[model samples]
Target: MIEPQPTRRRPAADVQHAVERMRELARALPARDGIAVFNRVYLTVTEEVVRRSADGLFRDPLASAELSARFAERYLSAVEVAAGGHRPPACWRPLFQLRRHPGVRPLQFALAGINAHIGHDLALSVVDTCTARGCEPAEVEGDFERVGQVLTALEERIREDLMPGPDLLDIADPLTHLLGAWSLERARDAAWAAARVLWRLRDLPEVYGEFIEGVDSSVGMVGRCLLTPLG
Candidate 1:
């Protein structure tokens, strides 16, 4: 008998294909499913990236797409792992763990998902792009920043769509404070810092492993806090 080859997510390697996968999730999952909420948010972001790329907005659209595609694969992989009955990476665990809790607001789910993806997946994605493109992280810094700008732009919209109005939630609310404590701009800066460090330590397997593990755990902790029930 012939041995079978292992399966791979061919879509994860392409921006358009990745968007399709996200769409698949959006269609299949419940509208209120925590994962579904995040999936919808991510889908909108990815679509915006594609639109901007097509509009000739990015300085290096190819590199931007490549980086975005790689960045998406990490989250998509985690979803696949969860679907396969295995725990995802530590960075993604908290979101999956508390996804359906009644007391956890949609905003919490959205932000927690963003926290996990931006905090951990993003740094590794930068490294992934560098490796695949035969370039340093600095070479792709422009693409990184431009893509991040898109997220930052959409973030306000995400809040408007998901966050309860002042009549519902207030500054005194723990959720508001939690949201205030985390900033996408800050997360982008930290992820860039981690990526530079990751690239430099790539030659040192042991040290790189430890550093990545630390990042994963630390980000996961923040994600868990973000997902905490408001009640």
Candidate 2:
């Protein structure tokens, strides 16, 4: 007969104290440092949302709606930075390229595919929000057109500079194949779809807030995970 192993005791107090320390660190972070924190949070939250959504978190229509709304908020946040008016944190470039890493590439491609599929849904959400609030379609479309141009340029630059070269051509080929399999023409399709949704949902402040909060929370979590680990 084998001796029984001791069960691990829970350390709730230690966990709570650790959390408090993390919060303090987050609070003390400078704005530049905060960007990396937020980006990490965004990535974590989005990945969780994607996983959960696929695992039937969206079985409830309301939860599904909330997830979609959150996605829109996160995408818009990134788009805002890409629009040239605001500079996104430097970490964004590397974080975005993390998708290309061998360990994380599959998930990155999945996100790219999802982005392509849901881009219109996001755009429509925005459009709907604006219209309900008395904004004209033309105005929303104009803003989207301008923003879309900037985003396109940014994506192109990323592909050229960060995406792997011919040595990694095999990986690129498979990715391209996967994109075709998914019937996605490009990642830009997702951006376009999001703009369409925004036009449609521009006036639903409550929905918008839910979306924004999800993103904010996600960002917070990511920051804590990435930065606190360093500390």
Candidate 3:
């Protein structure tokens, strides 16, 4: 009798497939739609993660892959929850709620989603990854920081690519200032801090859950502000 082989999870490969699926979906949607804009940004980030993972650039490839997958899962789950007619986290509520509003520009939509994901989802995802692997955040902090760097670099590109023409860079463009107020670096730092706090409170499930919920809702409020339409 042949021995049964243990199953392995290819986290990077899974992200690649998910990115491709999202890319196709974005292509099928109207370009100006808010969700499509964020989808494009997210797809680009996933592609970069997959590429870097393939090059063995991470300090711990397995942990990196797991962390990335867990991070992406949070975003995807929010989508499913909203699609099922249930509200997602407060951070996510803004994007899903205003995703189709004519007054909200694509740039606002993209940035709002980035704000929510980085501020709330990333921290929880860190906790989830640590729980799954029975390890400490310090063990995977390198991967987390590297991923943050990638997102920060990509965020610059997003601003340049999506911002209105040079003539509109003045105060007349409320979107410019609104997006500028949120920084990926700040969000990343806060996320790490939140992760540590959550981990410390983990033994108290009720407290841990409430902390996570508070983070989620507070981040959502910021997202709502970011997505506020400028007419």
* Root-mean-square deviation per candidate: 3.1, 19.0, 3.0
Whichever of 2 and 3 has more TM-score, that candidate is 3
Question: Ranking under lDDT, best-scoring first?
Answer: 1, 3, 2
TM-score for each predicted model, relative to the true structure: 0.92, 0.34, 0.92
Least accurate 10 contiguous residues by lDDT in model 2: 222-231
What stretches of model 2 exceed 4 Å from their correct place?
A: 1-103, 106-121, 128-133, 165-168, 179-231
Please tell me which predicted candidate would have the highest TM-score against the true structure.
1
List lDDT for all candidates, in order: 0.88, 0.40, 0.85
Per-residue lDDT tens digits for candidate 2, residues 1-231, read: 999988732333322333343344346544234332333333433444444445654334232333234334544455356446564333233333333233433223333423422433344444544544455544444434433443444443334432345344464454444323433234335445535444454477787656444533443333222222110
Q: Which stretches of candidate 1 lie over 4 Å from their true place?
A: 1-13, 166-168
Q: Write the per-residue lDDT of candidate 1 for residues 30-116, one digit (tens) a residue.
A: 887889999999999999988888888788777788888888888999999999999998989988988888899999999889989
lDDT by residue (28-99, candidate 3, tens digit) is 878887878888898889889878888877898888888877887788888879889998888899999898
Model 3, residue 179: C-alpha shift (Å): 2.6
Residue 12, model 2, lDDT: 30
